[model samples]
Target: MKASLLKEEFKTNKYDEMLKDLYEDASLVDYQKDRYANALDKFIELYGDENVSIYSAAGRSEISGNHTDHQHGCVLAGSINLDAIGVVARQDDVINVVSDSFNIAPIHLNDLDKKDEEEGTSEGLIRGVVSKLKELGYNIGGFKAFITSDVLVGAGLSSSAAFETIIGTIIDGLYNDMSIDMVTIAKVGQYAENVYFGKPCGLMDQCACAVGGLISIDFKDTEHPVVNHVDVDFSKYDHSLCIVDTKGSHADLTDAYGAIPAEMKDVAHYFGKEFLREVDEKEFFDHLADVRDAVKNDREILRAIHFFKENARVPQIVEALNNDDFDLFKKLIKESGNSSYKFLQNVYADFDYKHQAVSAGLALSEIVLGDHGVSRVHGGGFAGTIQAFVENDFVPEYKKEIEKLFGEGSCHVLKVRKLGGCKVVEE
Candidate 1:
């Protein structure tokens, strides 16, 4: 559809159903309508009014299985209402992208090879996704995209994953008949991040962002992960899902994040396996002494232990939520949090103990929620934010108390979005 027609479509009830499905909040329909309208106008103003399509890829929250995805373990994650949205028009030769912050330079389609200079830049992610799609024998093309996102960056919400998914989705919708599945789109996103964007990331964030809804993912086969949806409306449990950002600096913490999966793999290597998931739990426990000695790091052994327990807990939590057992679900969440804090040991970086903002956030969450709610280290941990399941009635108070320590507007109450990366329609 033309950008002008799409902007007019938003002025009526044309897109209400689609907006409702994506956001799951009736109250947010108008806001999304305005968001799409504003983005369309910007697209027209920047690239002229050509035929364009709208796309949205959700940001994700890790509900269970902290730091477990890299080891081919299971995890439970959800696509949040926060997302990266794009108004894109198909172009013939070169890809150009402009976001609210800055403009990515035009990327020539013929030059899809990984460029060392483009590392860690949006240009790299675009070229990388295109390159991976071509490598996988999928169709590739060019587009001019006006992108925007509400997903808080560096707040453990997987903003980068959302961006990557959006880019892949736009290409899929435009060139590949939208035939690429979400998992493949996710893998493309991960490839872009890992090889092109210069970040070592597991598939969990991209998978969740691309797949949508609350899902349990088993990565025992990294190339072909098993994803299953856990059908339940958590809002009905009378709890609000809140992610409290601690405003902590993630600078110079790549090594800290890298150490976790490396150490877990170290334990796996001792057992002549590549990932801890391949090792039997009983064998690990029986040969603890030898394994510990071989790894030469007690922390590595402890982290491996955490990987096993946390992996098992993902399915248990999924079952609990499926059975409508919110109480048991909450209990399991606390257990996951405890395991991550003690055994996984990613609550705070050892190098900077004095600035333990994540630790402080978790401590404050414990104090505020006490028994009624549950809080845990969110996402990659070591820094950033913490996730909390706060009782609905107490959300205002909970948000106030937590934001008092972090800052006002630091607490974000989010909803699980149903749709992942897809082209929006007006029907």
Candidate 2:
């Protein structure tokens, strides 16, 4: 379809069903209609009124597991309504992206080699995705895209994963007949981030963003993670999902983030294993003293303990959700938060103890929520956002009080979006 025709299609009722399915909030249908039409106009202005495709990839929320996925542990996560959307037109040999948030220079498909200078840049991610696709014997192509994202950056919503998912999704939809499965899309994203973008990240973020819905990912088998869609509705229990941004930059926090997996892996190395998942929980607990002496770091032992407990806790969470046990689910969420704070020790960076936005947010959330809700440090902590499951009745006050401290518009109440990365207007 031409860009102009797609804009017209969005204005009509043709795409309403698809929009509702993607966003999961009927209230946002009109908003999405306008968003798509405006993005189409931008695409027309920049790349002419050519035939184009629309795609959206969701941002994920860490529901049950924290800092456990790096050890190939189990995790419960959900894809939220917030996402990165793109309007793209297939070109010949080069790829160009103009994002509302930043600039990405053109990347030639011929030069997909990892560039040291491109590390940590968008160019690296783009080139890396294409290179991995070709290496895996998947079809590849070039496209110019105008992308926009609502996923909050530095707030632990997996914005970077969403961006990567969308790029791979565009290529999958445009050239490969959308044959790439969500898991492969996620792996491609993680590969780009790890090998090309220079981030030693686990597959949980990308997997959650690409697979969509409330999902439980068991990475014990890293190559073939077991993914199951958890069927439960938060509204049925009179609770709403809330994420409060405490306001801080994740820049320069790479070392803090990397140390987590490195330390956990160190503990695994003590037991002659590559990942913690390969070690038996009983063996780890029984050999605690010897492992502590070998690793020489009590915090790493504590983190290893957290990983085992949290990894076990993920299944209990899935069961609670499946059984509609909201109270038990909330209790497990609270326990997970306490474990992350006490054992995982990621709530605040030790070096910058003075700047403790995440800790502050968690504390304030406890005061406000008190028994009616649950709060925890969200994603690669030590900065950025906190996750809270607030009673629907208390959501307004919770958002208000949190924003008063963190500044207005800092708190976002979101719904779990059903779809992950896919072509938006397939009709």
Among these predictions, the greatest lDDT belongs to 1
Itemize residue pairs with steric clashes in candidate 2.
Answer: none
**Model 2 C-alpha lDDT versus the unseen true structure:** 0.91
Model 1 Cα lDDT, one tens digit per residue, 295-324: 789999889999999999999999999999
What TM-score, computed on C-alpha atoms, does each candidate reach? 0.96, 0.95
- In order, candidate lDDTs are 0.91, 0.91
The positional error of residue 310 in candidate 2, measured at the CA in angstroms, is 0.5
Give the poorly placed runs of model 2, Cα more than 4 Å off.
none
Q: Model 2: per-residue lDDT, tens digit, 252-328?
A: 78889889989999999999998999999999999999999999999999999999999999999999989999999
Q: Tell me the lDDT of model 2 at 387.
A: 95
Q: Clashes in model 1: which pairs?
A: none
- In candidate 1, position 290 carries an lDDT of 90
